[model samples]
Target chain A: MSQFLQFLFSGLTEGAVYAMVALGFTIIYNASDVVNFAQGEFVMLGGMVTFFANAAGIPLPLAALIAILVAVVAGLALNRFAIEPARGASVVNLIIITIGASIFIKGLAQLVFDKRFHRFPAFSGDDPIRVLDATILPQSLWVLFGACAIFSGLWLFFARTLVGKAITAVAANRLAAELVGISAKRMMALSFALSAAIGAIAGILITPISPTSVEVGTLLALKGFAGAMLGGMGNPLGAVAGGLIVGIVEKMSAGYVSTNYKDAVAFIIIILTLLVLPTGLFGKARVDRV
Target chain B: MLAREEASGPAWLSVEGLASHYGRIQALRDVALTIAKGEIVSLVGANGAGKTTLLRTISGVQPASAGRIVFEGEDITTLAATARVSRGIAQVPEGRQIFGPLSVADNLRMGAYLRKDGEIAVDMDRIYALFPILAGFRARPGGSLSGGQQQMLALGRALMSRPRLLLLDEPSMGLAPVIVDQIFAAIVRLKSEGMTIFLVEQNAFAALSIADRGYALETGSVILSGNARDLLADEKVKEAYLGI
Candidate 1:
């Protein structure tokens, strides 16, 4: 029983990070219909830049803030320079652009931050907390809480605020949104910035638990994309649920089945979900009248 | 009916020799029209006759390759669609493109996104009063509404922007005659309240009946223009558009 509980705790902590990444995917995808493969790089940037800033004697909170700010600027630059120039391109072409962007960012990070893995101290101390005979890291709780806070913040923003609804209106119908005075271009840039900030928070929360290298973004992005596909592509709530499911399933499979194939589980579930339920668990099938 | 005195002033909106193309295919060719403040002008045409294309150009969604569009005596031909909207030109696009996943209330709120005043709530109440059915479905997703109700929501949404010129593209399409009557009645009420409307429609009889001045468009050009009542009685318009 304690073993099961331990696996569950670890699964949940990991799932929280994936959930944040999935959310980033969903926001950009909704705003521009582009699945930004560079999402994971924001995570790496958060951890890496914070690590360097902390090494330079800045406080942890301030370092994290700088990281977030840097990530937002990078996101804006990506939208303005890369995405905007290639507007109205085919979906496949857009996907390739993001993929190319991911590779370019990864290469740039390796050059800027070196190839070594690095981690910083946890936000709350490295002590372990026990729950029902199972021990969990304090940082894990921080990850879980951070994820919950972000989800709630996004919900409030989309549900209660006018600007947030304008973003959603653009996602729903770009032409109609423009006709009603919502600037789709501005909304796209905002989505990128917001998504990047969310991703940076995820990175800051998880780096203490899992040391991050410059190349870590590739694996994280693949897992996050799988999570997004598992949840419906554009649904924020579904992305969270999908990410949690992926994380839990991965941990459970590693514990019960085979640790060697733990990574394989996410891909398998993604494939099966796509084959059987293409619209995803929470996605509504789109219907258009001619 | 209100007097047509508003039509005698300088044009509130003017399109001079406007031309648009879909790549190599020209959708509008040197099309010209004008609307004065507080005048309900109708552009009646058959499908593929460039009515929608012209309206879209005026709204700045479709770019004009040539000529100029002037709104309120200022040349606004180079403005973006959202800028045009901010300048008091709101379009209830064809097919009622309400945000399907959003609540009807949120759809209405989206229309007032650019407004910076405190009277948005009052305007919202007015919209609710205008389309009471929408008020009842305020919490429901816009996609769930029936066709006629969606049409009302679309019109109410446009009105939420407090636009000076309302551009409606086929407000009566795909609706039952009774619902069409209800929508037209609401439009008549708006005009009586001093709203300027640029209506585009294939339903010539319904459009011309309410319009003070009407233009007949055919194959990307304005072929005829006259008083709506006179056009309604024209033999050529009756044969080609009204099918009477």
Candidate 2:
């Protein structure tokens, strides 16, 4: 029973990180219809930049803030230099651009920070807290709660704020958004900044428990994309649910089936889910009432 | 070219040597027209006569290859579409594009996004008065409304911007005649209340009847311009546009 509980806690922590990444994917997707493959790089940037900044004697909180700002700048630059120029391109073309951006970001990360795995000290210390005979690290709780806070905060932002509604408007119909005086381009840039901030926060939270390297973004992006696909492309609640489920399933499969085959679980879930619900668990099916 | 009657006031908006292109195809060519304040100037055209493109260029959505658009004697030829909104230019696009997931009232509120005044609630009330059905669906998602109701919502949303000059494109499209009448009545009422309107439509007779002056566009150029009554009575306009 304790073993099961341990796996659950471990799964939740991993799920929290994936959830944030999936959310970042959903935000950009909704606002601009682009699946930002560079999302994982933002996460890596958060951890890698802060890890070095702290090494250079910057306080952890300040370093974390700097990392977030850096990620936001990167996000805006990505939109301005890459995404905006390629506006009206085919979906496949846009996806390839993002993939290219991810590679470019990965290269830059390796250049700035070496190819070494790095870990930051936990926010509340490295103490292990026991709950019902299951020991979970304090950092895991932080990751879980941070993700929850982000999700709720986004919910309010989208539901109750004017700027949020404008973003929603842009996603619904870009031409209409412009007719009403809302700049779809500005909204797209804002979406990028927002997703980057979320990705960075995820990176900062998860670095304590799991060591990050320059190349961590590739696998994290692939796995987080799987979670997004499992949830439904543009559904926030689905993204979170799908990510948590993905995490738990991977951990369970690793514990019970085979540790080496753990990574295959995401593909399997995707294949099975696709075979049944091709629109995803929460994806809204395209239905034209004409 | 017909001489514009500027008896009331100088032109509130003028499009001079306006041209727009879609790759190899030119959608508008040297299109020139003017709308005086308090005038309902309607542009009537066939399915592909560049009527929509002209409206789009004036709204700053479609790029103008060569030309200048002047609003209130200020050159806004290079202004972005978003800045044009705060400049009191609001457009109701061809299809009523309501944000589907937004509530009816929330959708209305989005029109007032650039407004810093405290009269938004008051303006919202005015919109509700114009379309009473929208008030009942205040909390419902905008997409759930029927086509005619969606049109009403779109108009209400544009009015929320409190625009001095309103550009409406094919407002009567896909709507029942009674609903069209209601919308036209609303437009006339808006005009009477000091709103400058530029109406683009395929319904020539209906458009000219409400308009003080009319311009007819063919392919991508203005083929005819005159008093609305004169165009309605013209043999060429009757055969080509009014289906006489």
TM-score, model 1 to reference: 0.96
Candidate 1 - CAPRI tier?
medium
Candidate 2 has a TM-score of 0.97
lDDT, candidate 1, residue A261? 91
Candidate number of the best DockQ: 1
Encode model 1's per-residue lDDT on A242-270: one tens digit a residue: 99999998899999998999888778978
Model 1 regions more than 4 Å off = A286-290, B1-11
**What is the lDDT for B188 in model 1?**
91
lDDT of 2: 0.90
lDDT tens per residue, model 2, A138-245: 999999999999999999999999999999999988998898888898999999999999999999999999999989888788778889989998999999998898
Q: How far does residue B100 in candidate 2 sit from its true spot (Å)?
A: 1.6
Query: For each candidate, what is chain B's TM-score?
Result: 0.95, 0.95
Q: DockQ each candidate and list the results.
A: 0.59, 0.58
